[model samples]
Target: MRGLFIIGRTTAQSIPTMLGIIVISFILLHLMPGDAVDAIVGMSGSASKETVAQLRETYGLDQSLPMQFWNYLSGVFQLNLGTSISYSAPVLDVILERLPATLTLMLCAFVLALAGGIVIGWAMAVFAGRWPDRLLTAGSLLLYSAPNFWVGLMIIVLFSAKLQWFPSSGDESIGAGLTGWAWFLDRAHHLVLPSCALAAFFVAIYARLTRAAMLEVLRQDYIRTARAKGLHPMLIQFRHGLRNALIPVTTVAGLHLGNLLGGAVVVETVFNWPGLGRLTMNALAARDTQVLLGILLLSSVAVILTNLLIDWLVTWLDPRIRS
Candidate 1:
């Protein structure tokens, strides 16, 4: 019941948050210095003034700002995201088409970061203040502060150019005759460089956060009692300390979910991946308002939904928070 209440409350809050996002996006895009109509007309190779006026009318650009926003909000409620001016396709369709690739890359990177971070963090906590911890702390700091794009380029140079291991850019290799598992393997091969580059900074951050969390949990009375009870060190660490430490880490991960999505835009551009991030980049370059707005709205919604899921998981992990 408490969990349901939390969810209900979050859902209610999200409604206003979403509205704000829509209004802000609409106003900013519409109020921007550059004219979307001009952008469209310019792209069409010197369109006549009549054609320009007709295009503006077709896009409802001739409407008053208040009226246009009202129509947009109404369409939003009806699942109408408008049409992409550049692609000549539905904005929602363009985003949906590219979503899977983004999800795949993000998920793969997330899993890698999570696993690597936890393992390294656990090891550091186990050997706190020792040479291993010191060495790893320095390394993590370096990685966490490095530019993701620069890291990606280095990865490509080493793996793609020097050793000739993975594909430099793309989610999958083109023109391959492989199928089934083989095709999947090729895709995974291509995914290696980008995923590693994207995951590196996150791994560094999670590692540090997990290490701090574990240290704090280890100092608790329960952990001391577990140690005094002659429990195996591994058991006490894994079953007791790490489990409790993960609570805060989950919150941190949820907080960073939006950042990860935003980072995907740059990462996807660097890798030339055909995901929503890359699509967003192209849309921005072309000043395609429909596609850009659609991508931003959907991305924001995804982040909200993910945070809600994290809240549920956190509640499940620590029922005391439900109070």
Candidate 2:
């Protein structure tokens, strides 16, 4: 019941937040020097002044900014995000087509980073000041310092180009008639590189966060009491130290979802992955305002909902936060 109330309140608060993002994104996109018509005309290589004027009118880009905003807001209320000039489809429909791939990529990356970080961090904490800790810390720093795109390119060059280990580009094999587990395996194979590229930076961040939190929690009075009570070191560390240490790690993970989404743009572009990130880059190049706006709104909602989920997880993990 309390969880439901928290979810409701959080969602209510996020309504204005999403609206603000939508308005700001719309205004900023319009302020840029190009529109969907410009992208279309550019793509065609030439257009007469009259043709350009007609295109603008067709796209309703001829309206005043205020009118445009009003119309867009009204449409938003009705769940009409407008049509994509590039894709020639309803904006929502276009986004939906790409959303599943993006979700899959993000889910894989999130799970890898969170799970890998926690384990690495726990190992580092348990072996503080030892060789394992030093080695892992240095690796974490390297991963954190490296840009995700560069890492992605390197992975492709080494794994795909040199070793012939993984496909360099795409989320799946085109035209493959594989089914059931075979299809799932094929998709997973394509996913490995992109997921690693997207997750590398975040894994480092979570690992460092977890290590610090674990160290702090391990020094607490209860931890000392557990040790004095002759509790097994592994049992105390996992059940007590790690559990308390997770609160801040969970908070940071929630906030980083936005960054993760942003990073996916570069990773997807690098991998030619058919995800929202790749679609976003294409939309930007074409100055497709409708598509851009739709993606932004959806991305914002995703981040918001993810943070809400994180809040629930944190609340469940730490009963004190419930107060």
Candidate 3:
């Protein structure tokens, strides 16, 4: 009951924040110079004033801004995101179709990052003040500070172009159907370079955070008590120190997951992955208001949901948070 109440309150608070994001995004997008119809008509200077007006009316661009915003708000409640001016498809349909590929990539990257971080962090923490710890810390910092696009380019050069170990770009081959193990393997193969690029930054941050948190936890009196009682080193670290150390790491990981999805624009474009990021870029270039708005709303909702899930996980991991 208490947990449920907390969750309810959290969700209630999130509503206004989400609304603010939508409002701000809508206003900024509109304020940007140039209209969708103008972009569609192009610079050939052939479109007449009558033709432009007709196009604007057709796309509801002729309506007052407030009225347009109101209609959009109502449409959102009905899950009708309007048709893309550019794609000619329902915005929601286009977004949903691409969502699975993005999610799969993110999930694989998250798992790899988490596992790698824990192992490296644990080792560094256990061997504190040693040369190995210093080396690991230095390597982590170097990777953490590196720009993601730079890392991605390096991966592409090494693995895709030079080594020819994986496909250079795209989610999968043109003819690969979405069924059977062969299809799965092909998709995974294509996913490797992109996922690694995405995971590398997270892995470094997670490892450093975990190492620091574990080191702090290990210094506590309780940890000393566990050690004094003759518990094995592995058991002492895993059974005692790890759970406590994870509170901070979990927070970082949750925030990173939100960032990964929202900021995948560059990485997705680099890999030519047909995800929300790529779609958003194309929409922006074409001034497709419907598609842009849909992507913004979807990304905002994803971040909010991820935060909510993190709250629940934190409450579960540290019971005092429930109160």
Candidate 4:
């Protein structure tokens, strides 16, 4: 009951937050120099001034900014996200088509980051103040500092270009018509590189965070008590130390979900993955306001919901918070 109340309250709070995101995104996207008509004209090679004027009027781009926003807000209330000038479809439909791909990529990267970070961080913590810890710390710093795009390109160059290990650019093999495990495996194969690229910095961050958190937890009196109880060192570290240390990591992960989506824009572009991130690039290129706004709104919702979940998880993990 308390959890439900917390969820309800958090969700109620998020309504205004979402509204602000929608307003800000709409305003900022509109303020950009080009509009759907300009992008259409460019795509079509040329258009008469009269044709251009008609295009703007057709898309209601000729309306005043305030009027446009009002109309958009009205449609939003009705669950109509407007139409994508580039796709000639409802913005929601266009986004839905690409949503699964992005979700898959994100899930893969997220899991990889969390699992790998925990393991690596555990090792680092166990080897604290030793050469192993020092080595992992330096490596984490390198990964954290490297640009996602640069790391993506390097992975493509080495794994794709030289070693022929994995396909560098795509979510799946086109026209393979594979079924079941074949299709799943093929998709996973393609996902490996992009997921790694997307997860590199996050892995570094979580690893470092976990290491610090574990170190702190290890210093607590409870950890010393566990040691004095004659518990196995590994069991004490895993069952007691790491479990208590995960609260901060979980919170940070929830907050970083937005940044993960932002990074996906570059990763998808680099990998040519058919996800919202790639779609976002295409929308920006074409000045597709409807699509851009839809993506932004949906992303905000995802982040809000994720944070809500994180709150619940943190509460469950640490009873102190409930008090």
Candidate 5:
């Protein structure tokens, strides 16, 4: 609201927030039933105590908890997210490799959800108390209450298993030598089911929120005044009402946008898309602490950035925010 200074202040707060997440993730992660060395040994069936001790020392597991945390913090400052015990790669590299797929999926889902919600919400508000409003409310409520994983599964069953319209799993079809626009189209083809699955719940939420906001705005003195002045209904609704309604919508968008990333874990798992969600799953299974911490940190950063972006946008849209 205060412009660059406010945004900068908020951005600075991210350091401590990220540090807290890192600390918590490091501590709780170590408390898990088995260590990375144990996971490695389990894979090979057996190992000598000497070999185990070496692995422990190698990973700095032998150090005191405070020391280990200090070292990890130092590495974090240097952009070293430590190493993945299972992947035998830097944590950042592993996450970055899979990041694009997750980003693409979330971005697509968010745009679709935001656009659909705005349109359906405005329509519902315009036809408030009528059959069209009732129908939209009923449908949106159903979607909002439904579990996304179940929705994703059903979508797959209907669209892929039955209709053969989309592949049920994976980011892309294997061995298809498509290039350029065709290549993008191929990726988009694989993206539809998962993105829709992720977006469905968000669309419902946005629609309900938008409808409520607009209806409230429509009841305000200014809106009534505009109507009394002989303004065109469409122009008043769109330019006057909708614009004011959007401030609250922007708040909701900022708060929940990061949720799309979290939701991607489930949808990605359901659809087998290579993204941070699936990577988180695999890291958890393997007790890959570095990768797990990296992902959690990245997720926290994303949420913070989203909130900052929304703050700027809301200020631009409503001067009251600048106060």
Candidate 6:
């Protein structure tokens, strides 16, 4: 019952938050300088006023702001994100087509970061005040602060250009179809560079957070009592301290998951990957309002859902949170 109540409250809060985001996004998009029609038509000097007006009418851009908002809201409820001005396909269709590639890349990167982070963090905690901990801490800080684009460029220079170990761009081989182990292996090979680029920042963050949390837990009365009872160091750390440290890591990881979905824009663009981030970038350049709005809505929903899942997990992991 307590858990259900927390969920209910969270849902209620999220409703207003999503609505606020929509309103702010719409206004900010509209307030940006330059005419959307002019952008679509290439130039005002070449296009006549009549042609521009027609384009505006075609996209319902001439409608009152309130009416436009109402229409968009209604379409969202009906799962009709409308047709993209640039692509001529439904916005949802465009999003669905590009989503899988992004998800696959993100999932692989997330798994790598999560596993690597926990192990490194655990080692640091166990070897606290030792050279290993100091080395990892220093290395993580350097990687965390380095620009992602620069790291990507270095990876390409070494692996793709210098060694010729991996392809420099695109998600898959030209001849590899979207099936079979051969195709899968090719895709995974391409994934290596981009995933590593994405995981570097996450690795630093998770290691730091986990180390801090574990250090705190290790000083707790229970940990001290366990050590006093002559429990093995590995057992005491793994069986007791690790679970408590996970609570903070869980929160950070959950928030970063949502951020990764949207924040992959730079990484995706750098790699020339044809994911939603790239698609959205193209749509923005073309002033394709439908596609832009569709991507924004999808990202917003993903963030909300990820956070909600984390909330539920917190309740499950620590019953006190339900209270």
Residues 1-323, candidate 4, lDDT per residue (tens digit)?
88788889998999999999988998899889988898888889999999999988899989999999999999999999999999999999999999999999998999999888888898899899999999999998999999999999999999999999999888789899999999999988999999999999999999999999999999999989999999999899888998888999999999989999999999999989999999999999999999999999999999998999899899888989999
lDDT of each: 0.86, 0.93, 0.87, 0.93, 0.90, 0.84
Ranking by lDDT: 2, 4, 5, 3, 1, 6
Candidate 5: C-alpha lDDT = 0.90
How many clashes would you count in candidate 6?
Answer: 0
Model 3 CA deviation exceeding 4 Å by range:
43-45, 176-179
Clashes of 1: 0
Question: Cα deviation of 210 in candidate 1 (Å)?
Answer: 0.8
Please say which candidate is ahead in lDDT: 1 or 6. Answer: 1
**After best superposition, candidate 4 residue 84: deviation in angstroms?**
0.2
Write model 5 residue lDDT over 51-90, tens digit each, in one string: 9999999988899989988998999899999999899889
- TM-score quality measure for candidate 5: 0.96
Ranking by TM-score: 4, 2, 5, 1, 3, 6
Q: Can you tell me which runs of candidate 4 are displaced by over 4 Å? A: none
Off by over 4 Å in 2: none
> On residues 53-93, what C-alpha lDDT tens digit does candidate 3 reach at each position?
99999999999999999999999889898888888899999
The TM-score that candidate 6 achieves is 0.94
Residue pairs with colliding backbones in model 2 are none
Candidate 4 residue 72 Cα shift, in angstroms, is: 0.8
Scanning candidate 2 in windows of ten residues, the lowest lDDT window is 34-43
Per-residue lDDT of candidate 1, residues 64-95 (tens digit): 98998888788788999988877888888988
lDDT of 1 at 88: 88
Tens digit of per-residue lDDT, candidate 6, span 1-323? 76687779988988888888777777777776654676877844577789989999988989998898889889988989888877778889989999998998788888888888888898888888999999999988987998777878899999999999999889998875668888888888899998888788898889888899999999999999999999998899988888889898988898897668665677799899889879978887877776777788888888888888988877677767755
As a whole number from 0 to 100, the lDDT of residue 5 in candidate 3 is 83
**Clash pairs of candidate 3?**
none
Please give the distance, in angstroms, between residue 68's alpha carbon in candidate 5 and its true position after superposition: 1.2
Ten residues in sequence with the least summed lDDT for candidate 6: 27-36
